[model samples]
Target chain A: GAGVSQTPSNKVTEKGKYVELRCDPISGHTALYWYRQSLGQGPEFLIYFQGTGAADDSGLPNDRFFAVRPEGSVSTLKIQRTERGDSAVYLCASSYTSTGELFFGEGSRLTVL
Target chain B: AQSVTQLDSHVSVSEGTPVLLRCNYSSSYSPSLFWYVQHPNKGLQLLLKYTSAATLVKGINGFEAEFKKSETSFHLTKPSAHMSDAAEYFCVVSLPSGTYKYIFGTGTRLKVLA
Candidate 1:
């Protein structure tokens, strides 16, 4: 069985540029989550989606971050006017439901120069 | 609000020795505690979880965590350390119900030496 997966394992971009990271969740997972992990830190929640609807986005850092899950299986995290502070590994995880055990994907490492 | 604290940022142990990674949590209610491990170049893997089921929850790879309500701790322990056990471990906490909003602690990097 395929676990959650992300595209563009590594992305390097200049500051002020826009970037998009994609995540493909496990089939039948109704809950998708996005988190960010800075070096030497644990993953911090960003946004959570439940079947095409965002159940929570409070963890999003600010207006510069946004995420969407249109069909409920795949999601994209978009960043506007990227800053060097945003340079970190963006992780995606999915679960059967909001309270179920989560399965994580190999994070997409974004390097903002 | 729910939060987890990993007391040690790094722990080193030799193979065949006991391994203990301390973690403490704070939550308004009974919390769902979990221990996850991540090897270099790999995603996080669920080592074990402690719901309301049992106080001593056993997880994969001979790892276990005992949920202590009195002490507000759910520390992970393993009898024998293996070289492969060298990885970053995270202690996470969430509410028992509702949205299951998670709060992760700063990771503890394990070094298993031979």
Candidate 2:
């Protein structure tokens, strides 16, 4: 794609429901990142991927949040047993390297009821 | 480890007036700093970035920031504030966490009053 693209710009789900958010990164980009933004806050790092493997997952918060970049081009963020606190904007970004500007998606606003 | 601190949680400025948003950072290495802006329903857009090169960096929308190593600050400024400039701004410092990982500040919400 021309830029980072995310699916289901808005998602509404039950507290216990599992949800999957998808991201398609910019073509040929080698790094992908996931972030979560709460109301009135900046984006928090959730994970980082270098190619198809996750280089750092320390920011995932808890096991309930998991992300996968299967082919190094697209990624998915999966949440299990969602909670109301999980309502926030999930952002995806891609970069050509680890030290350049990042291209961001419009973001997926996940609302858990 | 690296971290960024946005001095103000919110800032209000009259339209066409000068604007300033303060940011400070901590890092173990010569870090890369960046400023990102987010409108109501849009993605984050990079305003500018400061690597180890220039001390002053200019960005889109007539915004600029100066990287002060001694002060550990990268403050965003504009000569004139526009109503369209009202948005949330974030300061980010790249961490040596093995990838393109970043430590973001809490963010400053800019409000331009007409």
Candidate 3:
């Protein structure tokens, strides 16, 4: 698709399980971002990748949450030992440049039971 | 540290009436501000942005916002509200320097009534 694409639109997993969410950004976009949105709250920044390097990962909740953009095109967010509180919509966005307006994906909904 | 604050959590307006959604930001220097709208089960869409070129920014769907530096605000407005305008609105801010990560405000749910 032309817009950002996210896989596993919806995932249900038990606590302590591992999960990975994938995001395919628009072609040629160099800046990609990951955000987590909980119910009744705003999307929280998770990580940002510029090209193949992670420019910032300050917002990751803990060591259990990690993301990687190996080729600067597709990125994946990994969660280890997921907890019930980890349930939220994981949103992926990309921009032509770091300061440009972002184009977002429909988001991957993760439910931890 | 930069942050965005959306004043209203919920707003209800009748059809054809004016609509207002307030947003405020805290930044040491000039920042890039934006307003985005999200429909049910849809991705966030940009309504407009303020990049220091003009204070009054016009956006799609008859939406517009004005940047007030002294007041530190960027409020979204529309002359006449339509049923289609009902959605969740988010205010975002990105610093010109540094990480350039967008900071989003808690969304405001707009309800357009008949």
Task: List the DockQ of the predictions in order.
Answer: 0.79, 0.68, 0.69
For each candidate, give the TM-score of chain B: 0.95, 0.95, 0.96
Q: The CA-based lDDT of model 1 is what?
A: 0.93
Reference-based lDDT, residue B92, model 3: 92
Candidate 2 segments exceeding 4 Å error: B97-99
If you assessed candidate 1 against the hidden native complex, which CAPRI class would it receive?
medium
DockQ order of candidates, top first: 1, 3, 2
The best candidate in terms of lDDT: 3
Clashing pairs in 2: none
Best by DockQ: 1
> How do the residues B1-114 of candidate 3 rate in per-residue lDDT, one tens digit apiece?
889999999999999999999999999978899999999999999999889888999999999999999999999999999999999999999885334688899999999999
Per-residue lDDT of A14-67 in model 1, one digit per residue for the tens?
A: 999999999999999999999999998999999999999998999999999999
lDDT of 3 at A29: 96
Position B10, candidate 3: lDDT: 100
DockQ of prediction 1: 0.79
Q: Tell me how far the alpha carbon of residue B93 in candidate 3 is from the true structure, in angstroms, after superposition.
A: 1.0
